[model samples]
Target: MIHHKTKVAVIGLGQWGRNHARIYAGMPNVHLAAVVDVNSADLRGFAHRYKAEAFTDYRKLLGQVDAVSVVVPTNLHFEVASAFLETESHVLVEKPMTATTAEAATLVELARRKNRVLLVGHVERFKPAVRRLAELARKPIFIQARRVRPYDRTRTMDVGVVMDLMIHDIDIVLSLVRGRIVEVGGLAVRVHNSQEDLAGCVAWLLASRVSADKAAEIEVTTPDRVIRLDYLKQRLAIHPFHGEVEDMAIHGDEPLLAELRHFINCVNGEEQPLVSGEDGLQALEVAHRLLQRMSTVAPPVRV
Candidate 1:
């Protein structure tokens, strides 16, 4: 029961990190305490806009903030998140929690030992349609998920498509499926010079570069019906074998905003994190497996 406003800060003022700062600044129960970025020029402007302190190095805000959002690159997740967890500050780290499973496990253990909330920023889990799909997907026999976007060099270069894009569906599929992943395989092609631009597998598919507009959808097959979800449109469709399609009426909200609110709720001890550190670790483990298989065909560059 927090009687006073929670002091919060967002590190890494990239595009998504900027969004975190925006949402935190608007929250009534939270104080946008600080913002951090390597680029001092952009950091100063954002800090002034949000009326929060700016830091070139994130370590300066270690003890000052009650909670922190680690929106840095995937490679920096372990370093940035572990520092705050050790300081007893709750953390909301973006997806692909760390570069390796070992690092992910270390953070999870640190959070447990410190008795602090460690929420992973698997923002798709907060989408209303995805939330509804989790409820309806009781006996999913087959699942297919696709997420693709145009090539962007500004973000996600530290990792390949499997970690950057496919991990979202991997996390979602793990939640939906009751059985363990007994067998896994993958194939990838490098469309971008930096990382594998396209990758495909049995259950989930991901691509970072698309010829046309962006796309995101998940289709699940049950014994009786097929359910399709459009992530960007926030729409759900249920198709029975013999009947007309049923469109589910989903209440829409910004997924990132909902995710941040959940993080704050976990910080206040009012709720548990929907995507825990352990969950993020599991997703990272599976992603590594897929990457291992893909490497046989085309070795990925280590960023």
Candidate 2:
């Protein structure tokens, strides 16, 4: 059987986007067709190293690729991914999907209409620890997640930390709890940039309740025990009320590679996207709720 290689591109050569390019370049049965970024220097470097076409304008590769990873800024996600979808190309857009919930919904509908795969880049879903948590978190009564880090000046500052970081936790909690969010409230403060730099949100689910903290961890409590997952450490520990602490074994892999491979599989018609565009829209909805509340309540902080 002759297998045709899947032509793929990575739009946005920022820190995370470059990793996508590197991984796609090395994957089997995949051709890294192009890399796009406004920064000519970085684009040229990646193109030369990966031996793919380079484009400062993403529209140049519209009809040329089979699939693409939309790693651009939050504001540009809708435009870039929509264009690719219009060209019948599958898209794997990064987390938060788009700057607005409406934009997310549009992408979801567009992908459906075009019969193309629209996968969200919620990379955490690919983690082994997170996978185990999904299996063991049956009937979770309470959940808490913390994803905080020092401000990186180099990263895109177009959106607040809620949409940038907290959205991942929002996606996870929504996926595990699988309940309608009854209410949403949160407080955020802008310290370093125009956008909110720190945020904390609470979401009341029908069967489960969830909140956010100021660090990088997730704790899920059920009727019998509590499962603690450390995001950075990639560890899962379970503590029962009556028994000893039981550490859950996790087989870890580079999450980005796993996510990219899944996208490729979806493009190849071998599997469905684990994180679909609808899933991204759901997360973005919750994020907007929190942001809306915080905007009305939280006061600006002096840096």
Candidate 3:
């Protein structure tokens, strides 16, 4: 058991936030203090089901918990986390840390000053295959990643695919390369709405180099040694460097619960945070670079 107990609250009861509450509520060392959501039905249902307090005002929940997870929209991340941190509560936040780099920096600094554990919710990093691959990653000369969706018209109302989906692969790539991006190029198309649904980006990073990812965006990721991920027919594809590619149809599960377990471990001071604010900021920086470049046809080269 962890040395000290921790009280936690999950703010926002959206689809993603509900998962956060589920995981935290089950952890033995943590207390799922409360869940705050504007929707009365969702708030009541989740609170009763999880045996956590229900409230519409996060501020009210703030005084009642030691740590909180912010699962609201990307735009509200900075505002909500800041409020909780200012009150001396540790925070675990969902990705795209904040809408702006400055806001992300502010939260990072605020958490540091207060000696609070500030963790970002980058769920894919916790995948078993990724954890094993990262251990074996070496200098890779090239990299390519693809993240496609059937079409969730309402999912990305505030951000594009770069932020909404590709950002996951982007963060994974950046983490492995650990390089300074020399230049970035992108191609995106909005398959369903005003925002770009399909995005492809290439980063020329001055990286230390590592082995490439075997599976990206529904593809099975392979490492130098061992057969890690299982790919079903079209669900994921596993490649053999020496043999023909193998295809399988299977669904890869989301690792949200494992991620929250890791966050609680970080808060318990048993291990360092898996996704730090700096990591989130780095991913956001790359995401913004792609979108900014995509916005202009070719901003007449600066003389």
**lDDT, candidate 3, 188-252, per-residue tens:** 55444566655666652111011143224422234432222321122334455667665445434
Clash total of candidate 3: 12
Alpha-carbon RMSD, candidate 3: 6.8
- Which of the two, 1 or 3, has more lDDT? 1
TM-score of each: 0.94, 0.92, 0.82
lDDT of each: 0.88, 0.85, 0.72
lDDT of 1 at 73: 82
Which regions of candidate 3 deviate over 4 angstroms?
1-4, 154-156, 204-254, 295-303
Clashing pairs in 1: none
lDDT of 1 by residue, 1-303 (tens): 647899999999888999999999998999999999997566787799989998999999887889999999888999999999999999999988999999999999999999999999999999999999988888999999888887765654777788888999999998888568887788787765657768888666655564367998999999899999999888899999889999976886788989999999999999998999999999999888888877434545689
Candidate maximizing lDDT: 1
